[model samples]
Target: MKKLFQTSSLVSVLNVSDYTVALTWYSAWLSKPDETPMDGMAEWRIADNAWLQLDATAETVKPSAAIIGVNDLAACRTVLLEAGIAVGEIQDWEVVLSCDLHDLDGNKISLAQIISQQ
Candidate 1:
């Protein structure tokens, strides 16, 4: 099949109801956003080619999910737990170790650490 659009960058957006609360919670979970392009929106540079964005809206939103690639899932989970966040049990999938959590708006966020089989 022929390509429809030229590639540039990828963005994953999690729409939320409360901007202020979501901003604070996400800051604790992912650190301060690298950029706040405009009001009611925040962005994090997940990788050279990808980004994660938080958008504030009053309309109904379906829960969205995102997986973050971390180098140490255990340490990441520990930090979040200490911050009083309800993080889920870590799952070991042979090639990956991961844990899950929800944002202020119930958006599912997963932290995954890839294990080298070498």
Candidate 2:
């Protein structure tokens, strides 16, 4: 049998009342202001090629699964903080520094940077 492929793509959706506003913010956050928007959904492409989407019909909930790892933890944290999205404080794991946050819909979003071999 063929071995399973490495990690594929990811798509995460969050609900927001102001889809346009959310789109603008996400465009800046992802550094892709020209990114397209479809109907009630706006998407951001994370570093790992994960799709982070915002939908108008979604309801607030704890995320079942959502996270984005970055090369510069401190810088990423700063960006989120500057955008007023950082939740609580930065956490230090055995091999990473991470922050757990939520979007307008309350879906969990994590930003982390590796500190050592995992």
Candidate 3:
């Protein structure tokens, strides 16, 4: 049988206790304001089809994690640091380089730079 549907985009949600703080922090981290904003949520267009949504809630929520591929892990880390965001050490895993960063609510964002085979 033919497929009834096909996946197109991915939207990841991160729940936070404070919407304002999260929005500001994420905007700076992404270097762009949220493309969509609602009463208690904000969404950033990370790529052509990928989006990152921040949701505000009253209950304690566990931090969300997402892996974003970058062209230069070291440069990205430096930029984040200059922007005042704390970045973890970059790790070389034989096939890829990666680093982890946490948002204001402690949500983990893993940044990976794929090794290009020449």
Candidate 4:
């Protein structure tokens, strides 16, 4: 298997210092960003080639994490707490049913829901 440059798209970047408060909390927690090609960056096309970039780093030095894989983690945490986003509460992590979030430069998001009969 020697194919290393044929891959197309797959972005997963999460680095924000302050691009207008991370574009207003990732555009209401990953909503209005189908594309924003430049100017601090914000793109979300999490499928066909996969993407989820929200990069605007003047460079800090800590707090950075990401884990998003949700089918229905309590209805996406109730639509990210009704667009006010402070989502964290849906534990029971035996396999996967998790929740934890922290934006506003504290970047430590997680939203998992994968317990399909295993």
Candidate 5:
């Protein structure tokens, strides 16, 4: 069998009850305004090909979770703190450093920084 499709990008969605509030919070949290790809939807470009989408919904949307890799965990933590977002203490796992945080809708976002091989 041959590969039918190549994995080129990823788009993760986090549903929220309040679109305007979520948009403001996410814009501050990410330090960038979201792009409106359509009505009632906002998207943040996480990387070159990765995106995080926020959808406004009337129903109770389940909280979403994602693990994001960063180049500097400490720096990221500081930024989050300065932004008034609470983040867990950084834990060393021998191979990487990680911390956890949640959004307004209680969606979990884990951040990890890989240790470079010496």
Candidate 6:
């Protein structure tokens, strides 16, 4: 039997009614205002080489969307907060400091900084 595959990439899908504002807000966090927009969505290259996709629609995804691991969780949270976004409390996830936040479209995302090897 074929073995289950490993997840090579994580994608955060944000469904927004106004794609323009959504893209603008995310672009600020990314500090890549010059980056070209993708199809009907904007793709952000998060730390660890993951992708963040902002979609324009009314679709609602489960709150358990994604929890991404970053190199510096505190710094990421600071950057996001400085950009006027709400940064949730950080939880001790054993080996990581995990924090949760939502996108403009309300898709939940968790940001975690690993503190030890799993």
Question: Which candidate comes out best when scored by lDDT?
Answer: 1
Candidate 1: what lDDT?
0.89
Looking at candidate 5, what is the lDDT of residue 72?
98
Better of 2 and 6 by lDDT: 6
TM-scores of the models, in the order given: 0.86, 0.69, 0.87, 0.33, 0.86, 0.71
Question: Candidate 4, residues 1-118: lDDT per residue as tens digits?
Answer: 8987787876878888777777777777666899889988888886788777887854653667878788899998998898778887899877889899888778787888888874
RMSD values for the candidates in order, in angstroms, are: 2.1, 3.5, 2.2, 12.1, 2.1, 3.5
Winning model by TM-score: 3
- lDDT per residue, candidate 6, 10-74, as tens digits? 66666666778767766666665333465567677765656777666446543336777788888
lDDT of each: 0.89, 0.69, 0.85, 0.81, 0.86, 0.71
The runs of at least 3 residues in candidate 5 whose Cα sits more than 4 Å from the true structure, single-residue gaps closed, are 1-4
Clashes of each: 0, 0, 0, 0, 0, 0
Query: Which residue runs does candidate 1 get wrong by more than 4 Å?
Result: 1-8
Q: lDDT value for candidate 3?
A: 0.85
Model 3: runs farther than 4 Å from truth?
A: 1-4
Minimum summed lDDT over a 10-residue window in model 3 is located at: 31-40
- Predict model 5's lDDT versus the native: 0.86
**Per-residue lDDT tens digits of candidate 2, residues 43-78?**
777646677777775665333447788888777778
If both were scored by TM-score, which would come out higher, candidate 3 or candidate 6?
3
Please, what are the lDDT tens digits per residue for candidate 1 over residues 1-118? 9899899988999999988999998888679999999899999999998899999954877779988899988998889899988899999999999899898678998889999989
Model 5 backbone overlap count: 0
Worst 10 residues of 1 by lDDT: 54-63
What TM-score does candidate 4 reach? Answer: 0.33
- Model 6 C-alpha RMSD to native: 3.5
TM-score of 2: 0.69
CA shift at 99, candidate 2, in angstroms? 0.7
User: Least lDDT summed over 10 consecutive residues: which range in candidate 2?
Assistant: 57-66
